[model samples]
Target: MSGMEGPVLVVPGLNGSGPNHWQSWMEALIGARRVDQDDWTRPDIDLWSARVADAIVAQARPVWLVAHSFGCLASVVAVSRLADRIAGALLVAPASPDKFGITARIPDTPLPFPTVLAASRNDPWMKFMSAARWADRWGARLIDLGEAGHVNTESGHGAWPEGLELFRQLQASAPAMTGPLQD
Candidate 1:
């Protein structure tokens, strides 16, 4: 979507995004960097967030996060300490913190930078209302995708153009980076 002002960090959920997954396609489409976790099968917020934070630190510019499912959770936590290094975030189909017994670990306060959260009405990972609650808590704009299960390749969302549009919108709304990069 034109020239991006910052690097796009694509963060995938459990087991990682496969070749057929939309995250993989978006990375190919935009040259986005993927945040690879050491153990994708395990959902550990601390470890996952550390990996995401490290990725952001490695970027030469502020980053825009495109995260899915459990990766959404990790990205949010990672940005908590590095908010100034972030341009914006597009979080999709976030897994429920309650499901992982990490609700207390996730911040209940508003996020520092612009963030958009897209959720499905019938996602098996999280209830719609629960997603709404978290969206409000994070002060993120929420987009409702009715009955779109998980919004993954298995749910028939490979090469999701609509999600790309949402990311573009978030990018447009993000504040422009200024001055020198923080150390």
Candidate 2:
């Protein structure tokens, strides 16, 4: 939180991060808010991204997105048109766009804000190489987690300190924002 000048929004994927999930822990640890979606079972990028975008817009200042799995995909899409209000982003264990049949919807160009994408070699939702490719496409810095399964609570990653450090790094790397947010 040292370098962050605004709220941190946590976006969870699929069923949404449970109470024991790292996203929940991070939210409590750093006073971050979660972007609650209307439907967790459905992987509708349009609906999910719209919720994320609205959450960011509602923030009084710039925001940093901490997104996981399918939430990562939605977050990127949500920020595409609102990058100026973003401080940065830390995307972990992003689900494959192909798996959800939304590959065409995800942007192929670099993200407008500083971003870090963490990927695991053994995540069932997406191949390691596929994550690497997406990272490259988004011009995000990729971190290899080496066998960490989805980097979720089921993978035994509750209260993950390393992930917190990564978020800090993203904050440090983000360019500082000043003044009021523009409409």
Candidate 3:
């Protein structure tokens, strides 16, 4: 297996992932580090994006971002500005809210690099159909997981195998468009 090129950074939702959260499991699999933010608990999009960008630069070169909930939102917002810096992204359970001052900011466009959106059908944070629609808008491959509430530990989804399979799929489907000129 190829040694990891860049650290796979994991971004948690509003509350952040606890020990049992799926993102934590992902950290174990790929040596992922969280997107460090100044204020993690608050849903401040701009600050969150800035933190993501900074963390992306510091954590790994040619970074492959893996974000969940609010973290996913932060990544999406920053990726367009950091296009030249990223290889690919794996966004899961993005926190899109109409009242939290972020819903209007989400792009109706697809991200430049290879990307995927894994959403749950019964997530308290997002409706399945709405998440699928966002995926369609962003031109991301959508994996509709049935009844996986929020796809977090609260939903009884600690270390989800299916989600991990989806990550493997993303890694396999897309080639990293990074590194020095490898002739």
Candidate 4:
């Protein structure tokens, strides 16, 4: 995972992160592009996954994902079909679409690549326990970052240095070495 160049797609939550948001800040810092979602504020789950798959296909090299909120679920839905194209993924403060104890729209299959699930203890949009369960199901490394509600601009993490460090850690993790990165 050390030397992979990428078109890392920063997938934001409902409404997506604006230019001042952390995802935008991170995208610039990493020399990558945003997903440029047509409409993330109210996406159909299957359509969202399709766009993610399309983004993965559009990349010239290995693509990494940095997903926030419900975008995390979209990325998860894509994991099965896009694993060959993805280098890894970093899921931050996943907001469950299934708030009523319904299963997520995404499949529970293990992603065939490196992944980190960063969960907050006090995110108003999500329950940490449910996030943990998803992490286990996806076989992602669960990082319990103490209460930083939603881990967004409102959470005092606008230019979060700690989150940057975690992203580095995710990059240092093992990548799927054998597969050819998708176009």
Can you tell me which runs of candidate 4 are displaced by over 4 Å? 1-3, 100-104, 176-183
Which pairs clash in the backbone of model 1?
Answer: none
Q: lDDT per residue, candidate 1, 1-183, as tens digits?
A: 322488999999988999999999999999999999998899899999999999999988889999999999999899999998888899999999889999888987888888899999999999999999999999999999999999999999889999999999898877787435867
What stretches of model 2 exceed 4 Å from their correct place?
none
lDDT of 3 by residue, 16-79 (tens): 8888988898888778777767666787888888888887666436777888888888888887
Candidate No. with top lDDT: 2
Query: How much does candidate 1 score in TM-score?
Result: 0.96
Query: 124-157, model 4: which lDDT tens digit per residue?
Result: 8789998898899888999999888998888777
Candidate 2's residue-wise lDDT over 1-183, tens digit each? 244678899999999999999999999999999999988998899999999999999987889999999999999999999988888999999999999899999988998888899999999999999999999999999999999999999999999999999999889877776456866
* lDDT by candidate, in order shown: 0.92, 0.93, 0.77, 0.80
Q: Output the number of the TM-score-best candidate.
A: 2
Clashing pairs in 2: none
TM-score of 3: 0.89
Q: In every candidate, how many clashes are there?
A: 0, 0, 1, 1
